[model samples]
Target: MSSTRKKSSRGREGSKNRRWSDRVTKQSNALDLESKIFKSTNPRRIALSLKRSAQASKRRKGTPYQSAMSMLNFYINRAGKSLSQKQKRVLERAKDELRDVFGRK
Candidate 1:
């Protein structure tokens, strides 16, 4: 019984270690966006800045409009769980404003 307990504890420790390693790897591989969306309270400014950043990135896939929209959506989705209802609404409006600024339908 003692040996079984020891094995179970070791297995738990091994899983914890693996999770930590995975987190480290994910952090290193993460994308660093230049827009700093969370720091700004104004939806229009956030949209403009994100648009500029997306346009400047040569590595971004698709058209300029598509790239900008993708970045904005990614930020919103990544932040959705942590953001308040008001914040989410602001971001949704920003998406609309971004489309307007980009001349997208």
Candidate 2:
């Protein structure tokens, strides 16, 4: 049987990431993202960075907190297990700080 899928035009050979979500994470037009926005060790810093990105983005329709949390959750879900326990803890706390900074309960 023949496959109907067309070949991807992105990436070089032997690319392990063939998932569409990877492209969304990299190429999403949702916000003003800082490079390595998710790499920071400080929860508050990560939250604030996400908040800044969320607020500054013109393309997002949700409230800033929603956008920020969405992006944070996306990162947490996407980077699961690959993230160290310390890194995961930081990000989880970042969510709390994100709520605090946004005045959300």
Candidate 3:
């Protein structure tokens, strides 16, 4: 057999190795994420979100325009996350409504 034939056989093995490596990487990522979740009682993301909301609420000073803007911001931020298709559509509509209501001013 020629050296090219041997190289082709090795390439075939490399493809299989690639697939197994992909699976192992995915599984390890999942396990690491799970362990991180278990190690922390409170999720940092939610805590940060809540802290930001509180600061925003304080800054708004109970004004109508601020309230509307805050709600719009919350809706827009939420839409960026993993939402259902229907929910995404609803948020889009809500954003338009906010724009119309606030834009008129």
Q: Which prediction has the highest lDDT against the true structure? A: 2
**Model 1 C-alpha lDDT per residue in residues 15-46, reported as the tens digit of each score:** 66655433432332232354346456788887
Name the candidate that leads on TM-score.
2
- Candidate 2 weakest lDDT stretch, 10 residues: 13-22
After superposing candidate 1 on the true structure, give the runs of residues whose Cα lies further than 4 Å from its correct spot.
1-32
Model 2 regions more than 4 Å off: 1-17
Error in Å for residue 27 of model 3 = 37
Supply candidate 1's per-residue lDDT for 67. 72
TM-score of each: 0.65, 0.77, 0.31
On TM-score, the stronger of 2 and 3 is 2
Tens-place lDDT digits, model 2, residues 1-105: 898898777757546665655666667789777788777899999888888989989999898888889888987897453888898999999999999999988
Q: What is the C-alpha RMSD of each candidate to the true structure, in Å?
A: 5.7, 5.5, 14.0
Give the whole-model CA lDDT for all candidates, comma-separated: 0.66, 0.83, 0.41
Ranking by TM-score: 2, 1, 3
lDDT comparing candidate 3 with the true structure: 0.41
Which 10 consecutive residues of model 3 have the lowest summed lDDT? 30-39
Q: After aligning candidate 1 to the native by TM-score, how far in Å is the CA of 75 from where it should be?
A: 1.9
